[model samples]
Target: MNIGFSAKTKAFYDLDEKAVYIQNASWSEDVKSISEVLWLNHCGQPPKGKIRGADEHGMPCWIDAPEPTEQERIAEAVNIRNAMLMTADTEIRQLKIIEEICALTSEETQRLMSWKKYLADVYRIEPGNVSSIRWPDVPV
Candidate 1:
C-alpha cells in the first residue's frame, strides 16, 4: 500500500539544545522529498562529542560522523528516484484504468490495450494497467 499522509504531529531533535521536540505535521504526497529529508536527519552518525548538541549556528550537527561513501550516496539517489517513479506510475495507472473503463468503442479499447501491453513488455513497468507485467528476455 502507498504511504498516505499522517495527521499526527511529528517529533524531532532540537540540535541546538540537544533535546527532543515536536512540531505540527502536514500531509505530503511527495515520498521522495519526505524520504530525502528524513535521511538527512537520521542517516549519519552523531557528531564527535560526549554530549549531543547543535553547532554554533544552533543547527543539528553531524560533526563526528564519517562522510557518506559513494555507494551510500548512489543508493540514496536511486531510492529517491524510485519514489518519484512510483508516484508517476500511480498517476499513469489511474489514467489508463479510467481510459480502459470508459472506452466507448472497440477500436479505442484495443488501442489502449496495445499501449498497455507495450509498456508492460518493454519497460517491465505496467503502471497497474494490466494483470501482469512481462519482463524483457535480455537485460539492458
Candidate 2:
C-alpha cells in the first residue's frame, strides 16, 4: 500500500488502497483524498512504551505512551496473577476429575504436581515484581 500523510488532517492514509491507514479516530474513509496526501516513509513497529504518531513536520514518528503509575502497575500485576491462578485452578480441577475416574499415569501425576507448584509460585509473586516474573512451563 502506498502510505501518505495529510498535513491538513494530520493523518496517514493508504493512497492506493483508498483508506485511512492511521491517525484520528474520528476520520472517515470519505475524508481521504489522493491530491492532499503527502507521501510518508515505510513505518515499522514502534519502540517499547511508544506509539506511532506524526512529528511537527507531519512525518511518521514514534511517540511515548502515557506511563502507568505505580498503583496502576501494581493493580495490573495483581490482575495478571489472579488470572493465572484461576487458569491453574481450572487445570488442576480437570486433572483431579480425571484422576477420580481412573488411575493417573506417572506423567499425569507429574503434571498435577507441576500445576500445584505453579499455583504456589503464583501466590508467592509480588505485585511490584510481576514484570520480571519467570513463569513455569505448562505441562503437556
Candidate 3:
C-alpha cells in the first residue's frame, strides 16, 4: 500500500506532528515502489531517543522488526501475483456459472457441464482471444 493510502502509515505519521506528508500511495502490484517507500519512511524517521536495544551492538534499533530483505519482498510479490491470478480465475468460474444459470433447465447439472465445455473452447488463458481457450482443460 502506498504511504498515502496506508492506514498504518497514517497512524505512524500521526504520532509525530513534525513528520512530513510523504506520498499518496502505491499500486499493490508494484512491489519495488512499496518497498522503497517503506524503507525511506522507516530508516529516515530520525531515531527517537538514544535508547539501547537488547542487541549487544545496538545503540538504537529503528524497529524490533527487521527490514524486509529484497528476496523476501519479491517472494511476497510472487504470492500476491499468484493470488490475483487465482482471484481472476475464480471470477471466470463464476461467470461460467452465471451463463449456465441463464440457461436454466430441468437438466441443470447437465447443461452446466455442457456450457463449461463450450467455455473451455473459447477462453484463452493468456487473453489473446476469449474464444481460444482449449477444450481439454475446461470443466465437463
Which candidate has the top score in TM-score? Answer: 2
Per-residue alpha-carbon lDDT of candidate 3 for residues 34-137, written as tens digits (9 for 90 to 100)? 24354354434545543222223311234444556766755655554455455446655766677667854556556555545444443333333223323233
Model 2 misplacement above 4 A? 1-48, 52-54, 57-60, 129-140
Alpha carbon deviation, residue 61, candidate 3 (Å): 9.7
Ten-residue stretch with the least lDDT total in model 3 = 25-34
Residue pairs whose backbone atoms clash in candidate 1? 47-64, 48-64
- Model 2 agreement with the true structure over 12-130: per-residue lDDT tens digits: 66666543333435443433342322333324556788866666765655678788888888898889889999989998998999999998999999999989999998888888885
Cα RMSD, each candidate: 15.6, 6.4, 16.2
Task: Please give the lDDT score for candidate 2.
Answer: 0.70
For model 1, where is the 10-residue window of minimal lDDT?
1-10
Cα deviation at 62, candidate 1, in Å, is 6.1
Q: Name the top lDDT candidate.
A: 2
Model 2, residue 126: C-alpha shift (Å): 2.5
Which stretches of candidate 1 lie above 4 Å from their native place?
Answer: 1-66, 103-140
Choose 2 or 3, whichever is better by lDDT: 2
Q: Candidate 1 on 1-140: residue-level lDDT in tens?
A: 11111212222323333222123333222212223354366445544543233444333334454465766755655554455455445645765777778854666556555545544445544334332433333211
